[model samples]
Target: MSVPLTLAHLVWRMKHVHPGSEVVADGTRLRFADLADAIVRMAAGLHRRYGIRQGDRVAVLAFNTLEHLQLMYAVPLLGATLTSLNLRLDSAAMVARADRSRTDLLVVGQEALDHRSVGPAVRAAAAELAGHGITVAAAAELAADVETELPDLREDVTAFRFHTSGTTGPAKSYEVTHRDVVLHALSQSAADASGLRAGDRVLPLVPFCHVNGWGLPFVAALTGASLVLPGHDLTPARIAGMLNAERVTVAAAVPAVWFDVCRHLAELGTAPPAALREVLTGGSAVPRSVVDLVRDVLGAGVATAWGMTETLAVSTYERADPSVRAGRFVSLLEARIDGNSGSPGEQGTLQVRGPFVVGDRDGWFDTGDVASLDEEGRLAVHDRAKDLIKSGGEWIVSAQLEQHLCTHPSVSAAAVVARADPKWTERPVAVLVPRQGRLVDETELRAHVAERFPAFWVPDAFTCVERLPLTPVGKVDKRALRARHADGPVLSPDTPGGTR
Candidate 1:
């Protein structure tokens, strides 16, 4: 007889087999057995107090905390779908996503309700959600003294409703079944994949709101990897300290967060935790500098991943060797480069299909990335197809240019965007943030790009800025950059207000 693949099995395995595994958050550490009890109690409370039942939706607006993690499992155990709201989004955007979820209850975390920057927005969103007849309550209210038995849940029932990062367009929502969560977790824990195991102390610096913390929470429960969740205070100094305090073995976050942590370590003349063995980074291309810093400073190997909210946030993983290649596909997932499905070294749009991967009506998901496949089927993403600049019929990959520019000694971060040009149709322009106490010279930047890339690929103009804007999920906000350079007198490096 075959068993259904659901979260129930994962919970059972964690409680029975890995009861000693702990989840650390904000100075609180709860072992697997204790966490299982919490989930049971929380499920009972939701059922008895809020009347949350099977097929209902419960949305959470909180950071990565013990309470948030409990709700992640408890709502699904109650046979209700769990929805997460992006904390970085504004009040209106948050309200829109909450409305779209048709949430029966909204649980606002105390930390979020108390945050200065995000508190107002959370309150605004809660007020609007409550006005819509959706029951809104504080996250602190999720507790009960009695433990209740979990109901039988089907494998195909929707467990999570996730929103896309909205990097290229408006954020979109997708559903993942219990089977999708379980199978993805099992695939990620494979030796050749994320390699999460029983002894590994995994740190997910990524927000729970982002692809369910890149699905690491479930992988931890399935593989017995202890989780070290970085709560709301994501300061660089705080994160570096946690890495040492927790003795983290496998840490995951976007490239920007890693960069901050590396900088913090460098400034303090400190070393990364000796147990930090691997750093899993994605969201955008992991720069070669970041990979080098992780190895030289953090004493950790870098695993560059390629995934999206649609693909469960880590479908491909590579050892990164300081290269931007997105590694080969993991088990259960398959990809093709446009029309060149099996051909090696062919470049085109990347499309994927798999049992756990979400797809359109045609059964294949177009990733909207211009990519190439190596002889071993390893994937290398060039750039977003829409972000590529076409000048004189030649394509200029903005991601490649930005990565190359970031390698310059004077540059800390860089972004390349397409500027409308009547003569060439579209021209590449560079926005740069200089290293501390350094200035970026446009001529030097041009020479740097022309040294490796073709002469025409060199950005036509360079604008020096203090920093590049980022999307809610922390990828470079190229849409904002393009809008800035869309109609302005192309601001020169010498412009007084260029930094803005």
Candidate 2:
């Protein structure tokens, strides 16, 4: 029973046991058997036509499509590492990432090639890559008619390389071995954090290019679940339609996507289908209102997870108890609060280590997040270390402020950033996005915060935006916001208070 832990093994298991399972994408449905065959053909085609070999880096620049899913297994089958390029990155950033990853071949999605908004940039990057001897081909052009046997791959061989979101700074690439992927998938499937099960229809609204769609594709293949790909139609309405049409049991996405879906459901006077049981929300903080909405409208429990690109998508899953705000770490993962001298209730930098985790120097990897363990050993992430605002030598967690602001009935979303201050050095500024057709009163918001927090914790100024800018991965783009308002006017106690 000592089988090698490779993605190829997972695919072979699915092909033999769950071959009849369906993977629906873009109104087309294909069985797991067909998918297995296609992957073999694609692997053979890539090797014979493109000369792809073991240890070569294959970069895939695409959206969430069937083709992208195929490459997720096919590239690894050839014993080559797959680097999924972020489609949302600008041309320069995209090219820089490709160069940094040392990609040998670039596979562009046909849809991305034909896209009016992003196609030109992809082509420009492709041309630059071509000049550097990096062969560029459309994913559709890489298929072959002949099947190829899977190459022998070691468990320790690097299977995939993912680039960080680069929200705070330059994006860093992290490699995950075949063993890492297999263990992560098995742990997630067994944990059943999102209530995934065999034959359950699963749809990942997050792109496969992002943390392997939070590892849902692999988890689906492992658990015999039907994988539902949304293709390029990620609109809230479209996603809702697919959820109903496919009777999806489990779904995952960032908080922003769920917000839009809730709005769409409200507009349509509809609720999620009866089959939908769980909605996993992450990528950013999940507002309490969102959790309440999903439970009330969709009748699905919302599970909030916390992880980074380096952690392989998720590390903690909220416990079943509603009173527990923190989540428990998955099996085989160990966590601690760095530099914490107090009891478990004290907050500090969160560090984790496990077989699948990266950046472990001395058996501990700093997560760059401030967290605390409750009496029940559940983790509560307060805020990112870089996002904390220091005023007069005191740290103010921005996530706490954002969460309180989102509780306001009229606010749809909120982001807090540190604004440079002449006296305080850094002051908290609140950015509010109002609910549709609702006007936000700065005086009312100030009063709301003034009641919950001390005078110092209240934001010095408030800015209302139609929509907060988000990073490519859908988290609030606080760095961009800080850069935009860093040199702007700062409000003080002596200044008159009004909405900007």
Per-residue lDDT of model 2, residues 67-186, tens digit only: 899999888889899988887888888888787447889999988877877788888888888888888888887889988766788888888988889888888888888999989888
Global Cα RMSD, each model: 1.9, 2.8
| Model 1 alpha-carbon drift over 4 Å, by segment | 489-500
* Alpha-carbon TM-score of each model against the true structure: 0.96, 0.95
Clashes of 2: 0
lDDT of model 2 at position 165 = 92
Stretches of model 2 off by over 4 angstroms after superposition = 319-326, 489-500
Q: What's model 2's overall lDDT? A: 0.83
Worst 10 residues of 2 by lDDT: 491-500
